[model samples]
Target: TVIDGVTNTTTTVTAGTNPNAIAVNPVTNKVYVANLNSNDVTVIDGTTNATTTVTAGTLPYAIAVNPVTNKVYVANFGSNNVTVIDGATNTTTTVAAGTSPVAIAVNPVTNKVYVANQISNNVTVIDGVTNTPTIVTVGTSPYAIAVNPVTNKVYVANQLSYNVTVIDVASNTTTTVTTGKRHNAIAVHPVTNKVYVTNQNSTNVTVIDGVTNTPTIVTTGKSPYAIAVNPVTNKVYVANYFSDNVTTVIDGVTNTTTTVTAGTNPNAIAVNPVTNKVYVANSGSDNVTVISPSIDTALPLTTAVTSSSLVNVAGISNATVSSAPAFTFTATSTYAPTAPAIRTVYYQVDSASGPWIQASGAGPFTATLPAQSKGDHVLYAFAVDGLEGGATAGSSGEGSGNSPMVGSVAAFAFSVIDPLAQIITFGANPGPVNYSPSGTFTVSATGGASGNAVSFTSTTTGVCTISGTTVTMVTAGTCTIAANQAGNTDFTAAAQVTQSITINPILPCTPGNFSATGNAPCTPAPAGSFVPTAGATAAIACAIGSYQPNSGSISCTLASVGFFVPLTASTSQTPCPLGSTTLITGASACLNLPLLNIDNSDPATVYDANTDAVLLTRYLLGYRNADLIANARGTGANLRDAAQIETHLSTYIPTNQALSPFDVDGDGVVLPMTDGLMILRRLLNPNALNVMTAAEQSAITANAKRGSLTDAQVLQRIEALKP
Candidate 1:
């Protein structure tokens, strides 16, 4: 039945029942209809309306065809299977899939099969090689699948989930993208990779970004069921099932929709990308309507060169041309709808020049040069289709002709060269190299064209050395270097100069001690066990008598609270200063003392022994003793020196209280011993000190002697003070 243009009567097909999917084979000119209720495929010869039923899948619903493979895929809804029919022999191969297969699509590039399983909520991926199925989970109730050849992205529409699941072919990862309500149909613009999904309930379309997986909503007529794209113009056509009209156009690039009037129940759609024409299956009208996508593309001037026909004077394939010349050729294809067939295109000019011709191949074709006597030539090649009408030619015919075609092209340029230096020059420079620790460092200059003879030289010895382009330095000094090209270098390019390199060295701390009053600058004596040499003992003895400063300029008052004294041969080093009141908690003390002033005179003495009180408090409060010492000494900071000062001065008592016994060996653990002989043995021989046990060592170390007393003399006093 057919719809009358003048009357309002609705026509329908004879009771073939539940015709769900429809497709046409342009080669055989046959129309295939998948009948869900009949469990078979309805084949209608395109030239004649007569139809024949072939038993195929159970509850067959959707159908797709591979032009190259010449096979038709049918979705078996009831048996969860697909029927692959050989068009030539009409034989079938059944492949198992998910619970309920509803729709199917074929990938032109890989010739793989994809079936949407509605009940399983996934799509079954079929390997064309092994004919095995891999079920890939999609959104709920996947109703349709479409593949974009250019981007190799597969889009599946889920009616119940209201979303589309995109499958990346390379990674096989699934990303769910929200779409219009009840998405039922999907199609992809091959060139743009823009996917269009038809919403059955919300009466809208969803535009998807193939690369970013982003979705843009587009409104369409009510109840859109299927969609198709014209690859030639990147336009889309959607079939609206309930609106009784078709959304005639979609601009893939802009994602715009436009509706056009059509017969009732427009259910299925397909596009011939080559001709830019769309075919919509009107279920109610039981007929297919064709619409052309308006194309506006620029055509190259040299369209005649093609893949199969390029040749030289001897007609040998793979010919070379010396110069650009105007030549032409014919293009033809044996496939029906011959326009979509891939044809080879070739030229021998920088930008689309030389004798152009078409060959029979996929894409990326080899060119045959036209016979010519030339000086120079540039060749460019690509693949195109002739969906629009064009003339056919014999094997040995001239390619000078016209064909309306659109496809991809890649133009390559190769120049004839003589033996000459191919110079590549680059500016070279070195990064900063000022490192810690005094040592030699070599930094070779980087950057400059390849094959340039580079030589380097330095201005300082041992600090840096240069051999060829490499520079090495082993000294702790700064030096500059230059890299120059050899005389026989290919080209005269400017040389590179390097920045200076510097190295730092480690330093040792000077030793001394001081006694100051009123928080004076009394350099605390080096604390802990000290083994003074003969020379050091002599210096200490002289300084002790004359009350003079030591070599480190350390001075102290005779009766100040703080002590600064060096060790002599007969005196043990007094580790702690004289103190008065509070008991020490652990080894640390909080002694409230005033700052003392230092006398920078002949002896440079500080009457008050608290010379460093203010600085010590400031250092402890700021928690930056190292920084303070670096500033005072006008040199790099030393942590070891700060540790030494802290060890000796960290423990103190109030200077105003009654003087207590400073015992060097009669601490509580020494058990009431006041023998001077034992005290001297513990002080003089460290082996005896070690043999005294930990308790004995603690007893001797705890002794505190102040005022003009040496370490050994303090030990004797400690023996006298013992309990």
Candidate 2:
């Protein structure tokens, strides 16, 4: 039969006949039952409630499980041997034991098994992996065994010797502590390393501290035969077979015991630490009794702050300036039979000795603490449940709550920090300012309350900004940075202190200036020199292909062919015009060349007389007599000779005569002798050719017979005939 701790419901599963001992594997949730009469072990799946049986040594009296390996160990009293069952395979192996082995225990961490030989008064240690046995001598009639995997120690209860034997697993050595006579069961709390032994004869439990190996007898129900402990809660449970009740011992700094009713003849006890529930196997009742530790009124579910919003204070002195921070404490009352509800929460400061102040509402409730003098302080909080009769004042430090339900308490320790004293002083003032790289200054409060926060502000924000105690330069200007601290109630505010900071401008690099290294400003170099970066001690002359036209330029500009700056500090110059040449450096303008009436047969070659004649003949042949007539008629000018008349009448003239092509002087006239003679003179001396306009001359030069001719080439031909 298995009971759900949460719902208090029971479910039964069929097993082999006369099951004497039962153990659970928490990892797999499988239960192993030792059937003494059937001489087999019944395995029950907790989830499915399915049963499977495996043959074991005769008269199996006790069973234990190693959750880590999923192995089951059964003590066979009649056969004097132990059965090891593999939970995965449902197979068993038998190992010989001394006399009748009645109790078994396993250390999952070390995979070691301990079996108590009742008649032989010894314990058999079997290596779970190797299945090898090592016999260790104990007290007379060892009945029960328990192992603490963390400490690697084994404890056995010797019924006849009236003592408990503690064996060190590493050394295989035994130490005996006198306990009540007829010790039937043993259990250990791993966290506290405390050993608990249930005495059937004395009807009490002997608590042995593993550290000191000392025993403290705690009274329990009549004929207590089985014991178990919850390391999480540090609670020990003892099952009394005669009284049909179990004793619960709160293993605190001082042990406290309470009794809870159980089924008849409770012979074995086990605890599920996860649920804090104790299960007692009753032989007389032929059923298992489930005890919820939460329902024990004598041991009220301790009140603990499940969650909190308060920041824990490390030391006594708190340095908060804002109103003392409010703290919200949420407390949960332990489960009890009556479903205990928290009625009121009490708090006290400095000492727990005084009358406790009750909170207004049920928690989680918020409470504000009064400001305290600078020193150590303690705050204690606890909740009283409805089951408690009422709050009762007591002279002792302990507060009494209503009957049946007790209160749980928690304490906090902290100190209030003294107010900061006021004194203003600057640690560093502004030093000399430099240009290129900006400068920095620092300011600090010298004598202020410890932990007092200080703020910094800059009067001239545009020039500089202050962060914390440091002032950084922004631009070229003077700014004042101030440090201020606002004191708390304990200390007066410090006077604001101000310091002035000046930021210098970055110097411009000169044309002939250069920086050899970083940081330093560029210095003047020799004339006609320059550099690319700042901090130069010497300057470099402009490279052959580059020049500097302006001062203070970091680099030089490439020299344009037509104009140049040859000397140091040279500034302005004019570019060479068309039809001129400037071949040397620093020439203001291009030099003009002489023109000649030469033919430019090959435009690629220099102008000569032959190319000039070709150009004249082409222009002459393209001219028409009609152009001369139209020019004369539109401008009302005379046509001079027979040749002029003949040229003018050669082509058809428009009735309006709006077009004029014979305006050789571009004076808007067509005097044939003047224009025609001008053409003849130009052919002989092209420089005298005013008949052609600049546009006409440019066109002719562009469409020269040899090829396209440049302005310089046409100018050379035109200037060659100049007087």
Candidate 3:
């Protein structure tokens, strides 16, 4: 069953006997009751009110919970053992403890429970994570344990010793301080993180600073048995068992106390920090009493200068705040001011509360707080605007629905902001030379800031070339092109390009024939040396008349026939060009010239078609016989003597025609016969024009004897003369 303190009622759970302590599981809203008379624990379903009683140690007077572990520890006063109940299973385990454990409290920060053994005058610290107990020393008759969440400290009320012990949860050390007399029950103010211990004999409550463990005794009505705190209003409530009433009030701030009437003998109390409500166990009345903060009020503005206090006065730049502090007044609220006044802001050393100081004011409507200690600090501001009668604080930009206090000041809270720089990244990297001849290359800058110019230079030479946004690469090689801005002489970005060049070599002539004057006369022959008879116009004349050469050894020279036909320039033929030759008859007077006397030379009937008769007879036989051949070594000739030609002629003519009588005619001289072997030899020698063989001569002679040489003979001669 869940207890509602504001409504003064418990939900789901009905009337039960001697509910010593009522602990609610906020998760399930189920109420667990420690029944002092029944020696058992009753689990009441919050929604249904169904009661299930589980047997436990005798007289369970105190109960504490570990919300994270889902376990509960009940201090069984009569049994001398704490009943540990697993919330999940409702199963119990009895853990041994010292004599008469009166109160139990859990440190939610560590989930550890600290139990006060009243008779033993000591405390047992149970580890929630490990389920182990540590016996710790304390004052006489340690009766109650109350923990401070912010400092993780446990405060134990020593009833007999009239003092309280503060146990540092982290170090497990204790510091004891005497309050008044019979310090029994204790509670912690969730909002202020302060501990309130009720001194039963002294009829006063002691307030201990959770952070400092310093105590301040607050006088109450009668002997206080139970204590609770309202987290919302940060007030302490203590139940005076003998008076049958609870005194409710703020511990440090307020001077007076308000009493809350409850059931008889209110011995146990639990406060819900979230809702700021209290649940009291009235053992004599057999019921639980619920209470809320009925008279909670807003704090008065502080006038003393403290770091945490806000300044409300307008145009008060060098301001201090304390007891008469600045209050945050709302425009819509009845406490708001009707006129505007400037509000000053300040900070403190390492905390919001401090000795207030002035700050600089810059620009219009802007106040700059001076730097303070390293720790966190908060700034608060409020303006005092005078209305019709008196002055009230003005609301600036405060949150809605909350109380109007010093926090509602405008420009009171601010933080500082910090600036940084951006880093640049490059896409491509630079490397070795890219050109063939190794010249510095000018490169373009792309993919970077627009209009950013780049410079290319030879790293070794310091020769610089500037580039525009779109640069053309001129001289190619390894050139460091640095991308730079105007006035940034030291380039930040750079790259490189490598190029290879290829050129073809010049070509020469193919090492073959090319001449200035025709082609070397086709062959190395004598000048004007005719291929056939020099003056012959008929194919028949060339076929049988003489041996002439266009190439090789038998090439004829017209100069050798000087005696036969003397050089003449009497008349121009006009048959061709002026300097060219035309057919003209030489006088018969020179016909009988010794050089032209073919009739008397040899037997005019015979001729060696392959032989140079005049050259052979004059050079070898010592005569210029018309029937003889000339033998002379040419300047570029490969032949040596006439014997070689004679041998060559024998192979062409089939039989050698010597200057013997057998070959001579009746004139006692042999002529190269126009109708003999001369015609046949000419056909065999590819270099000869006129020389012929016996069979060729016989054929030609046979044709001549027929009086009309057959057309077949003529065609044969023409075909043989072709290349």
Candidate 4:
């Protein structure tokens, strides 16, 4: 539905499916509508009712027309591409764009187009002459875009990062300007070089100074979305979607605003600088509301300042009040309205940017504002009359849409004095602290402004913990303490002050203890055991080759060579006895010397053939067998043996009188012809030459054990029998 401004009548012009955004070319008198679902554009001829359907990229979201260049641009969100159409021929060129292109704006003077890519977090700058694209990086989630043709600068609003990216056309370099959280829409006034951005999440507007790139916050109604600018009047129009049928008009000169009644859910807004009129598209009511400011706002002239001078809400004629004052208004309009000039009085604290409260009644109407903040404040207000077709009402409280009247902006200033000054004081800094013991702190406060009693807290949670005024160090680092005192009725609240505290770290464990993670408290090794490494748990014992005489030692000593430690954890090593010895270290037992058990007839040191052999021969003949081994001539023959000769009777080899202790050789028989004869021959000859055959000189018997025995073997058995 299109409304004729002159006739005040409506006409229906058919468009493509789900038509969302519209743009117009004043030079050609052409209108373009972007159809999101149909993936095309519906072009309407302004002179005639003719319509043309032109194909575009998928899900076309935003459209902008360059009247000077006679070109139109559409940003396709789904296709990640841009559709550019020639206004003269309706021919379109598909240009590749960044991912998820959401908004597009053009600079007609420079003939350049900029598309904001939300997902890619960058912008694609397109040259109108060639349709070529250049990607310029931006902040995260770029949602809206606008351009200043005069300065040749492009601005992109990043919703997630809460900042605006300003791109210089000459250098392509960007400067970031911070804004409120989750900003969705932006508008730039070319003449003032000021940018207006609507932040939906924060319910405010961020006004950016183009020269300094500085941002100043302007309060707005809930969820402000669409924005437009009228450079001629220096006014910025903002559509407050959740604010319930209202739009805030901001003065670029003073940053002050006046709320005029609009339509339900007044979302999309635009202005005509040529006519100085503003138009708003109401989504909920499905109609367009035209607002004519009628020369500096249709303000009713008041005769005199009535009780509680209520003109400016700043309406108080620049008067300052100490308390909340009651207001009464009486005024007349120039156009001669159907009702009183001042039918209702609407005002808001601080600025005219509302949530405005209204007082609608007959002449001498009176109203009072609720409790206000204590500081310099301006009360902005406007009056609406019963004149037909003046302004629309954004809310039911705005009365009839017949006459839209806000009073002449008079400066209203007021001050509320505070009774007491409350502050929190913390003692001097307590330098660095050890991690071992916790520290205690004291605080003093004047409670009314600071709030409640004095309380302590730690800002660095990972480094320290605080309970009341006590601080416990958790690790090595810096610890900051914040002291707060919530105020009472006499004061508002005191600002929080802080102090710095340092925490020293703990040391590592020493040797002779098992301390894991390098903490304190080391353990000692067990008795007769030792540990080699610091912070070790395992204990090493003394082995056969090594010993540790003390406990809690780092190492053990090796046993000396020829000495031995037989058991584990032994304090000392033992040495071998007289007859038995060990040649190596760590021996468990010593070996005895080999026993020489020869000398059957004599226990004496020396032996000869004369006396010892004669006794042995006679004894072997079986005469007095007991005296055979009991020979007096040879010192009781073999009374003791070699192994324990002197004292050990158990180890003595006793004389065997049955035959002979030795048969001169290892043969079984002890006959005179064999053993006895061999002993006699050896003892009698001594070094004499043998006078016998080889068979007779052989071991004296045919037995293999006797006959194979050499003379040295037979003599060695009888202790080398010789005279």
Candidate 3's C-alpha lDDT? 0.51
Residue-wise C-alpha lDDT for candidate 3, range 488-550, written one tens digit per residue = 111223233322221112222121211233222132222223323222221111111123333
| lDDT to native, each model | 0.55, 0.65, 0.51, 0.68
Model 2 scores worst on lDDT over the 10 consecutive residues at 651-660
User: On residues 613-688, what C-alpha lDDT tens digit does candidate 1 reach at each position?
Assistant: 2233334344344653443321223222555444433332123222223223333221213322333334343443
lDDT of 1: 0.55
Q: Arrange candidates, best lDDT first.
A: 4, 2, 1, 3
Q: If scored against the real structure, what TM-score would every candidate get?
A: 0.40, 0.42, 0.41, 0.42
lDDT of 3 at 66: 63
Error of 1 at 95 (Å): 1.5
The best candidate in terms of lDDT: 4
Give the total clashing residue pairs for model 1: 54
Q: lDDT, candidate 3, residue 321?
A: 24
For model 1 the TM-score comes to 0.40
Cα RMSDs of all predictions? 27.8, 19.8, 27.6, 25.3
Candidate 2 per-residue lDDT, tens place, 404-511, comes to 444665555443433334777876655557533345767665657534787889988888887777677778767788778887555668888887766666655544
